[model samples]
Target: MQVYCTKQHANNGSNRFCTQCGEPLPLAVGQVIDNRYQIIRQLGQGGFGRTYLAEDKNQFHQTCVLKEFAPQVKEPQDLQKAKELFEREANVLKKLQHPQIPRFHTSLQVKLGNKDFFLLVQDYVDGDDYSQLLEQRQSHGKTFSEEEVTTLLRQILPVLSYIHSLDVVHRDISPDNLILRSSDHLPMLIDFGGVKQLPASQGFWFTKLAGNHTLLGKKGYAPEEQLRQGKVYLNSDLYSLAVTILVLLTGKEPQKLYDSYQGLWYWGKEINVSPQLEAVLKKMLAYKPSDRYQTAEQILKNLPLLTATKPPTTHLTKLKTMIVAPGRQRANALVSKFHNKTQAVAKSIPLPVWIRPFAVSLGGTALVVLTGAGTWAVVNAVIRSVTSITIPSISLPEIPQLPNPLGQPVSDKGTKDNTQIISRRQQLEIPEVFFIKMVDELFYTSKPELKGRSLTSKAEDTALRNEWYDVASNFLDKLEQANLSTATRQKLGNYRSQDYEIWRRQARAGQLGNYTISQLNKDTNEKFDRLFPGQQRGKLNQQTFGQIWYAIAADQVSKLKSSN
Candidate 1:
């Protein structure tokens, strides 16, 4: 039961003035105004008013928020004009009936001690605001994860859609205005002191209000037009929402997330997330009203996998579901097949007895054991199979149900397939000679039959190189298809531009020198050592050099077997 002065200094309930700053104190606690609502304590202070936690005595002591409309105007006509604006805006907000939004009760004016108090009554949501939640996380050296932010956006966008459909725009949409409700863990929109109806019939009445028209939003969060000219568009709230998300993600203020000099949000590069999500966020934070997403529905549509009607049945299905891009589906199918086999092997093995007791304690949904080949187990919580049974690792030879890269049957035979020959006149985009030359540098390994020789002659080298190309072509054909997700495609593109393309260019120009060790990733570095055990980088024969690059590409493509 306390009041605060204009300087936000707390004062005793009985004091009419601040003892420290000597400014007029706000409504004292225990003071019942309008004989129905009892003042409790100050909750917050804003540009237009001070919010108090109050009790609706008429409704069995239920808690509510009373927002005081304290405009700094003295003239009789101006005061009357402010009252009309407040009532008009409140009536518009009263039409909103969203569950996530606090229900607006009514506006009341009461005279207590030679002064007037205009109060807005709303449902008091009992939970921490996002700002407070962020503070708690920051104290522990953490911020809202990308997943949390996306979930928040998914929930809050619908509320925005509901309100915008009613032609109401929330001018202020910072993290402070949103509350994570304790009753249902849903984000609740709490403030409407700055809500404005956007119908053409309203004729921009907000501009006429005194002491609060330009004070609707916080700096850095609000877009330029809204802050500078007191003009707000449907997308203005979206800009503020993006800023709020950036703040939650980086735990930094809006000023730090954005670069005022460059007039762009530099936070995108700082955070590691999907490029698709970054693009959507960037568009929402666009400086121009027209450049931004005009409606929440538009943003939902453009969001990364948010509007998907159903989940993917398989890794291949997921890749095809996404928009087509070059090299998108290239390594996905190959990686999925390999990953599934390894996962099956990893799961089918028997668990140790020492860990068995710990696993069974986790409950029934812990581990689901699927027996036999071509099947996999899902690890839910802990692995606690009571019986000790050993399941041998399964080898899957052919996936007949799935189509091959070129619509041919996948052979049970290993990588070397001499019968699969490319017809030159088949109008194939891939040149057979390209693969032949790509692997030409690979010398033959020492065979038991060819005892003393460790390297193949020119003619023997040519035959082995051609055989290797046939296998490489299978991967190339899939990569050229148009069904990969943008992320997968971009990853493959980087491998080509930064690795494969550089090697190919050097080899083709006959200027291949010592390969750049610094440019090689960990996998490539290891593979290089295995291929040329005791040889220096610049001293390898052309055959071994070609084999190393091919192995590098194969290894990279195989790594994607686990990627979506």
Candidate 2:
């Protein structure tokens, strides 16, 4: 990594100790704060303070970073100012949630031997700063594509939009503050320490003698207003943004262009550029901030106008005609459409022999010949019968009474009595299992559609009705292992009222089988298994069980009984 400054340059340059106070720098790795954040490594050190990548630990919590006031360069006359700036940066960070902007979580002080102060914790970003990106591209003799430039501008302009909405101007906009992902090439803006708010007046601002010529911003790109302690607004940053884009496109620094033109920052011919784009860039680099856009939003509105011009090629004109002209011509379109439809029909026609028409004619002639032969045979038989004499009359005997049904007669009354007794016994047995199965059937009524319903005549007994409904549902589940018919299953279901009675009645009798019906009012695991017997093979809900059970009992009980 780049060493921003040795701990010694604490105030201005480089050194292991704080430069102002000459106190030993307290910045280090693995320091804990508020019993939460653990410092990882120093990210960078600036005039304000040192920033460290840290991990947050609520309980040895997690990895993150905290940027806090640098160990005060002892007796630096501007310590109070530095401290205010640090807190403000933290405050601005805490208020923002833009993805392009880093997130600030909390503030706290770390106390060690006669000292304590806060370290600002922020979400870590994982990409090279824009300057490194530029250098990497230059190393390979490459430049960003128009699409790539457009993408970078679009990603961060929204951040600018948001910043502008808050009435704050990010006075600094340059390569180092923009991060382009090494993987996807998406851009994000970082570092808001340079922001200045627009005041209540038409053109009020906060300005100072800024820039150490360090990488926060570059020379020629910074508007004169910012360079000379003059009031600046959104336009000031837009100028730098335009310059940055131009540099990315042409791979030439704005200062080189300005120096080549005797300190005129505008791009005319100092940078190898297209006339169309250079014209737009000239307005941005025009020295006076007012001569450029008034806001980033205005810049965004005008970006689409910088599109690449078409080449003056006769060949392209001919190709465009071939592709687009036919679609517009009625005659050519008819020919193209006809050819497609005919080709489709040719593919669908079946083999000729299977569909030949003559076979039906041959079958019709064969049937006619067979009918003629049958008619001749019948005519001959009629002649022979008419020629023959009539025979004497004879009477056929009637069938004797069928053997007394199995040679025994039953007394109808006696049969009726036996059947009645058998029927009553069967009715009870039938209902026993049917009621149980009814419970199983009731479960389906617990469908999502019926979740909160309680549509019964006995509304006052909704609780009781639901109670038994649950018992029935659970009981039917346990009854599965019992070797019983559909009727028995239904009986178990219908018997929830019986089980509820039993449950409330005994409050003592536990298990009729592997599970006790009382579990419906007991713990979740038992109730869940009964409500959903195959639950072990499905998902378990520790928290939702009671709610799910109540829903089931309320909606599904009546429907299941009706089905039974």
Candidate 3:
């Protein structure tokens, strides 16, 4: 709420009151000051014109605070003094530079009610005031801890020394006027309304302000000398510091801790200041100004350093720790976590409805479908036969006559030629086993051995086509008698790979030269590991391979999953 806006004066109406201050205050919008500062927001209004958070539009992003005061409001006798005082504060601020001090960027005026009101533009700190800090601590149902009080003292002491070095008596020091940093939470002295810059080491001698002094500082903060109808000294601020610290630690007004009857600070019964620091506070708050720390530098030289930072909120602290720059690294990290690289588990493609009748129901499914009354014997017998068929060792025998290099031409004329070919097929059943072994070779080579050698891996030679099918039969027969269920063997037979490989022999032999690799792949699809053991589910990761795949690396050991 550092931003305060004001309304303009009406034309027809005769309103004596200022549209901004709610009193007969002065100042209006669109009034420029010093021809440099442009009054924007009406920060506050007093008998003196107004205060505004304004800007220098000519400079990019340049912001300055503007305070305007009406000349008529200054009492008749003190009008000149007040104008001089206001200007003096501006001039004093110009020369000051410290972390705790607010800078006076420029000072000028804006016209309001036919009177020129001073507009002082200064820096705007984006932070809370010391009053807000107290309110926060009180809301949490706690007083500032001793460590916290000590830290506040340490941080402000250096600033105080700097201010005093400039020969300026702040004259006013309280919580409402203290500014604090949001990032570090350190306190900074602000609002130099009563700042008086002394000449070198000589402070200006001014009339004692009694009632004004008491209202300006809390009871116990104004040193007795300052209150006894007297002038102020450098120790005045230190006395106020002691009072501020006492209130900070105990969350009580400083006067409450004193026992006037005892003529000294009351301790043990009503106050809780520790003995060591209590001595320090007592000396600081001494009735006579001379007994206290006269300068902020002397006070700090003796006191230990203290630092306190606002502890972060749980969510904010987490945010601070996890902040990541937005760009490629962020994108890549997210993608890496979820990208699908490993192969998916193999799944059985549903056999077309037309093929359902041809499937030999010879396993657990046979029992399931038979419903046990009539088909029970056949189903049970089939299951028994399937389980009983042990895997016989594959002992390769002599190779048979695979079709001749240029076999006998088709027999439209010779019916005897067809019968002779048929007779030969029945006599030599060796091709069935040989074709299966050929697929095994292709599969094995596609793995570890070939690695990335797809180009060299193709078997296009005339001899190799005869050979792929020649070995295919071996893998098939061994799979059939391996105690696998009849349904399992049928499923294997339907595997696009093995069947395609069988059909591919003709295509590979240039019988169907137009056939693509896809056609050959489908014809001889030797997709093994369709029923991988449960433990190896995601290892090979083929959909049809879970409890349904060939034995491979990890899944190969002793875990033979039964066929479906």
Candidate 4:
């Protein structure tokens, strides 16, 4: 028997890890989890846990997704915190009840060998994520049309509105999380791992649980506030959603499309969309959360009515060509079929005088005359009169001079002037109700900045420079609430005190002998050089290196604190 790893590498059933990548392969085929769900295959894995395709044997072989709670944290306190977050995910899913959202089944714990494995079962959504769909489209040299994307937004925005009404924020909204269902062709919002319930009031504070500070969301797709301070609001999801649409439009990731230095999105020239749609998308992708649309409802209300593009030749011109050309027999057959149907209906019930004149006149017009000047106008007038029947209007080309029997050329400039008049008339034909609806759906734009209230007491900048981990962490939190600049927020977010602590532990265990400074990435190495310009990189072991790294980070924090 063979089993597939999370990366979809085939392995022998008895193998503990993937042969190709060496990633731990937890569940083997036919392994019964919680005596109910039998593991079929590993679907995917992330930082949180591995998700598996499973069969609920007790429930008539129903397919479901079993999300395993397998955080890499080793400490008991961290493990307990991870468990609480895992349970919170299940609770969030249980509260959500929408057709577009996968239904939460149950959560169970089972012992696999000596370790306790926790599992969350949810209704298996059978479809490809938007990321996969976009890839498929790109492979064929195609992308989603504006109409298709607008329809997608219309379908998914209501789902966001529903969740937001329940006070639940989907923190992670990206192409990977949106699945296009095979059954209905509608997108389903999946993966509630980053789901956070909004506090009832600004004053109501919930106790900060362990692992709560751990950033949860994709980096490039997540807003600055979310990536920097782990702060997620209702509009945070909206920001990610806008990034997702931009990715689909340009067939490029958010990182590539956005100018991080200039803080501007360069998506306008890449794809052709309406000015209205572009404006709305820009607001949604605003740098500050307060500048974005406050709610999904506002987005829906402001969304413009999508209009079809004008064709080079009108439908009436095509109909005229079809009537006069060799395909005249086909057109006559269609008209004859309609005439016979009208006759059959007339025999059962008397035709009205208005309808009878139009029905009889259709037969009197010769095939050549039907393609002539006044005939097109007569057909259009009849079409407009039958508004009660709800028939679609046929677009007509501008009237051109009929060809003379002697075949004299007609003036082209006269035809050009007539086309402009017809175009203006068509524009005026649109109902006033459309404009009224657009006016009624104007967007709300009164969102205020989310800066918290000022602190009465202040801490000295020297305290942050003391090289204490507890002090630096508390200072970072205070700086976040103070509404610091983007550069300052980024500096604080990238601070690697955690990395220094890991090195400290490795040094205490005498494992520093096996490590080298060269293993650090280019960015980290550059940062190290800037901090300790004279220090020898080769001689800096984990113990000595951690000490210097810690001191440098502390000093930088102190400088930022004093400047603010």
Q: What is the lDDT of residue 505 in candidate 1?
A: 42
lDDT (C-alpha) at residue 344 in model 3 = 14
Consecutive 10-residue window with the lowest summed lDDT within model 4: 326-335
lDDT of each: 0.51, 0.41, 0.42, 0.50
**Alpha-carbon lDDT of model 3:** 0.42
TM-score for each predicted model, relative to the true structure: 0.50, 0.46, 0.46, 0.51
Worst lDDT run of 10 residues, candidate 2, spans: 370-379
Give the per-residue lDDT of model 3 (tens digit) for 124-151. 6534455555554564465565545654
lDDT of 2 at 419: 26
Candidate 2 local lDDT, 448-530, one digit each (tens): 34333322212353443344345443543443433243222222212222224423322232212234433433443344456
**329, model 1: CA deviation in Å?**
35
* Alpha-carbon deviation at 468 in model 4, angstroms: 74
**Model 1 misses residue 435 by how many Å?**
66
lDDT for predicted candidate 4 compared with the true structure: 0.50
**lDDT by residue for model 4 (1-564), tens:** 454455667677566556795555668545788888887656677644578878898998777899876433336765576567667667777888887799999988666654556678999875567886676467446556554566567667878877887777787899889986533344789987763322323211111222425465787888988888877778988999988888887788888887889887775656557888888898988989899999887887676543333111111211111111100000100101112211121111122232232221335662211111111111111011211101111111111211111111112222112232223212332111111111111100011121121111113312211212232233234333443333222222122334344334433443334333233233344566764455454434222233233334334433422343
75-133: candidate 1 lDDT, tens digit per residue: 77766866787787678768978767889899898765555557789988755688876
Q: Which parts of model 2 have CA positions greater than 4 angstroms off?
A: 1-26, 59-61, 71-83, 112-116, 182-184, 195-218, 260-263, 266-270, 305-564
Pairs of residues at least 3 apart in sequence or in different chains that clash in candidate 4 = none
